[model samples]
Target: MLKLMKLPTAWGLRNASPFNLKAEALLTMSGQAYESIEALPNKGPKGKLPALIDGEQVIGDSSLIQRHLEDKYEARFDDGLSEVELADAVAYRRMAEEWLYFINLWVRWIECPTITRDAFFSGIPWPLRGLVFGRLQKDVKRTLHGQGLGRHTREEIYGFGEEALAAIAARIGSGPFFFGDTPRSVDAALYPQLLNVAEAPYDTPLREAARKHAVLTDYVRRCDQTIFAAREDLPNVA
Candidate 1:
């Protein structure tokens, strides 16, 4: 049996972490079964969620996990696409995981608003949860600062996130998936973040911007229905 380490679930997704969701999506796309369990913040290689263990092989990072699966199975996510198209798919995958991911983090941590903060605090056990959570928040703030989003105003941050969403929406363009017909690895990486922005209970400027795009929201639902519907942790379609 295979196991995945990830965060607690929020909304209807398997996990709140985009990388974890991506790994799960990749696994779903691979037609493989794996179980997910909680991972401490610093567990696994590189201290990240979405690590995978198959027998003695321990792989960390969503991208690394993707590579491992492809190598072990000798399969390709963009199986039917041309070389150029596969290259395009990989490009979008990086944009979603590398660029869009940071923007989503700004809305969650930097904006902190109330719902997200409360959710974070609720994850900690009391007595020490407050102190530990506060320290964690501070560390995240510094990380965002070093990453450059912390320097921007709230509106600026939302605007940046919106731009990334717009690029995604534009690329999708009424297609069933990013590349049309079949979904590539990037679709697996993308669905969770767009779903997060669109369906999160708390109001956010990023959500507002995302809601304006029917295509993107529709795509999220489609992915959820296709890849996530059978899981026990899956939620009702939104």
Candidate 2:
């Protein structure tokens, strides 16, 4: 059996960070079965999660993992998308990966403690919520500095996130997936970022706005049911 190293036990619906969710969803959609191992990069692999070990091959990072899976499974769409379509996909994926980071940072630093505490504690059934929260706070701070958003105020981050999301929504148009009919690479990539923002423990005004968006909310629900169901069943990480 192919084994996926990740924070979630299975590939689908795990409460993983966005990147992990994307990788798992892709795997699930491909009809591949993988065993998952909980990874704590901060404690073990230099602060990474969702690393995959398949036999003697060890891979880390979500983008690389997706590429690896695509190569091995050959399950990506082959219909020739126009250059414009391809470009739009790449652009959306980048925006999703980049802007969503700030959303997560905002949630961890500002919103998580308030809305997520009860949900997180009640879900975990473990006594390590404090430790998890502490680590998440530290990680978010580090990530913010790494992304050059450390100096920006929360208001700035929120504003930027709103703009980014609006841009994504505009690109989505009336397509069920990012690419209209069928899901493409970009759909797989961006969906997780949106999912993270919408489902995070924080229910801030920004998150609530995302939730209110019909298309975005529907997309998250579909991914949760189809791609991430396995992860959702696991004990909450924190």
Q: Over the stretch 117-209, how does candidate 2's per-residue lDDT look in tens digits? A: 454444554467777766767777787787777768778777777777777777776667776666666777877788777766566667776
* Candidate whose TM-score is highest: 1
For model 1, how does the per-residue alpha-carbon lDDT over 1-238 read when each residue is reduced to its tens digit?
A: 6788776676665567777888888877776777777777587877778789888988988888999989997548867778898788778778777667777777776575456657656766776776776677788789888988788887788778889889889999988988887767878888887887788775877888899999999999888777765565432211
Stretches > 4 Å off in candidate 2: 9-13, 42-46, 114-136, 226-238
Positional deviation of 210 in candidate 2, in angstroms?
A: 0.6
lDDT of 2: 0.67
What lDDT does the true structure give each of the candidates?
0.77, 0.67
Report per-prediction Cα RMSD to one decimal.
2.9, 4.7
Model 1 steric clash total:
0
For candidate 2, the per-residue lDDT at 178 reads: 75
Residue 136 lDDT in candidate 2: 68
User: Can you give the lDDT of residue 210 in candidate 1?
Assistant: 91
